[model samples]
Target: MPREISLCDIKGLVGSELGVSAWFTVDQSMVDSFADATNDHQFIHVDPERAAAETSYGGTIAHGFLTLSLLSAMNFDCLPRVREQQMGINYGFEKVRFMTPVKTGSRVRGRFTMAEARFRGPSMVMTTYAVTVEIENERKPALTARWMTLIQFDPKDRPSET
Candidate 1:
């Protein structure tokens, strides 16, 4: 069974390995959809024939941002939730780098590590996760990023001042 953890539990678990999701495939269709959505119809992303003929990657590659966006799905699958918090927001990314190409029709998985956890009054500022999405069968990672999320807990729900 998977672990069920709350928001407070995460705060106490700073500098620990959070979780990692099972591998997911990046198919050509998905890559094409991302390219259409972003208007980035570069041959490397959408044109399979052109990509095969020209790029050293030897096939269509996924967009870097597309791989970055997978962090959310990976987080949902791997990270334990904060039941008390009504919602969590994607504050921003501290840093992001494309370490290697994610070729279409390849599988990738993300590994998350809890970097820092701090409280800002009622809000929990989590400087979490150097997320590394590794391409299956490839030593080089497809993407890496430092992502942050803010979880807000209601003051009224807290233990009374005593």
Candidate 2:
């Protein structure tokens, strides 16, 4: 379940951990589907047999983008939702580093920290999260990124100036 946060309080929570998502398995079928959707049928991602022989991973691995794209669902699973916001948009990532390959059948989840939050306008707030995607039983994380999101709300909902 997503936690609820008042838009007025977001800035106060900077540098705090928002939440951690539940584990999600990245299996071959999902990888294959992602490959089909994105046309990234590289052997390391789609061909288990060949990948086992050719790569150090021992089997097919998920594409870096596929793993990165899981952030949307993970966000919904663990991040807080702004109580007064009508919608939120992906503003994109400032930085992304794929440190470890996510092998097929690996379970991964996201850990989010509120790195920064500032009001862009009366109706919009720009938030940056320091994110880490951890693979189960792995010493190193699959990836780390600085993600940005734009939250839009009614201007009338803004708190009165003191």
Most TM-score-accurate candidate: 2
lDDT of 1 at 93: 90
Per-residue CA lDDT of candidate 2, range 14-97, in tens? Answer: 999999999999999999999999998998998899999998989999999999999999999999889998989999999999
After superposing candidate 1 on the true structure, give the runs of residues whose Cα lies further than 4 Å from its correct spot: 157-162
Backbone clash tally for model 1? 0
Off by over 4 Å in 2: none
Query: TM-scores of the models, in the given order?
Result: 0.91, 0.96
What alpha-carbon RMSD in Å does predicted model 2 have with respect to the real structure?
Answer: 1.5
For candidate 2, which ten residues in a row score worst on lDDT?
153-162
After TM-score superposition, the amount by which residue 91's alpha carbon in candidate 1 deviates from its true location, in angstroms, is: 0.6
Deviation of model 1 at 11, angstroms: 2.7
